[model samples]
Target: MRNNWLIAACCIALPMATGAIAAYVTIQNVQFWYPVLRKPIFTPPNAVFAPVWTILYVLMGISLYLVLREPPSPKRRLALVLFGIQLFFNFWWSILFFRFHSIGIALLDIILLWLFIILMIRQFYRLSNKAANLQWPYLAWVSFASVLNFSIWYLN
Candidate 1:
C-alpha cells in the first residue's frame, strides 16, 4: 500500500513538473516577441500567468487522479485519453508560439486544444462530475487563451 502511495505521488508530480517546465519556457521567451509587435491593450502583465497556471495544473493533476481511481472500463480510459490529448495540446502551444514563434500555427494549435478540452470535460463528466467540474476553469482559461492567440496572430 505504501508503494501505491508512492506511485500516486509520482503520477501527480509528472504533469506538475511538465507544467512548470512549460511555464519556464513561456517566461523565458515572452520578452522575445514583446518588442516585435503591438500587443492588445488589454494584455495582462506577465506576472499574472504564473499564479494562474500553478492553480490550474494542480487541479489538473487531481482531476486526472480522480478519473484514474475508478475500475477499468471504457469510460475511464476514454476520459483519461481525452485528458491526455488536452495536455499534449497545452504543451504544444508553448512550443509553437514561444519556441518556434509561429503565431499562425500557434493559433491553430490553440483552437484544437480548446476543442480537446471540451471533449475531455464531457468525457470526465460521465466518469465523475467533480472531476469534470474541476476542469471548468482550465477550460475557461483555454477558451480565453484561444481568443488571445487569435488576436495575437491577427494583430501581428
Candidate 2:
C-alpha cells in the first residue's frame, strides 16, 4: 500500500516537474517575444495559460498514476511508453515555439503531440476507463492549441 502511494506521488510529481521546466523555458519568450507576434483574434489572454496548464498537468499526472497502478501487462507497457512519448513532445513544443521561435516546426510538433495523446488515451482506456477519461480535457486543450499554433504560424 505504501509502495502504491509512493508510486502515485512520483507519478504526479514527474509531470508537474516537467511542466515547471517547460514553464521556465517559456517565461522569457512569453514576456518578450510572444507579445510581438501577430496572433489569431481567438487567442486567450496571456494570464490564462499558466493556470490552465497547471490544472492540465495535474490531471495528466493523475491519469498516469491510474494507469501505472494497473497490473503489469503488455498493454500497460504500451500505454506507459505512449505517455512518455507525448510528454516529450509536450515539453519540447515550448522550446520549439518560444525559445527557438520556430513556429511552423512547433506546429508540427504539436500535431504529433496531439496524435500521441490520442494513442495514449486509447491504451489507457484498456487498463482504466477513468484514467482514459481524464485525458479528454487535455486532448481538447491540445486540439485548441493545435489550431492556435497553426494560426500563429500562419498569421505571423
Cα error, candidate 2, residue 25 (Å)? 1.9
* Model 1 C-alpha lDDT per residue in residues 33-69, reported as the tens digit of each score: 6556667876778788778888888888888877888
Can you give the TM-score per candidate against the true fold? 0.91, 0.97
lDDT of 1 at 140: 88
lDDT of 2 by residue, 1-156 (tens): 999889888988888899899889788999999999999989999999889988989899999999988989999999999999999999999999999999999999999999999999999999999999999999999999999999999999
Best prediction by lDDT? 2
Model 2 earns a TM-score of: 0.97
Model 1 misplaced stretches (Cα beyond 4 Å): 1-8
**Candidate 1, poorest ten consecutive residues by summed lDDT:** 27-36
Candidate 2: segments with Cα more than 4 A from true spot: none
TM-score for candidate 1, residues paired by index: 0.91
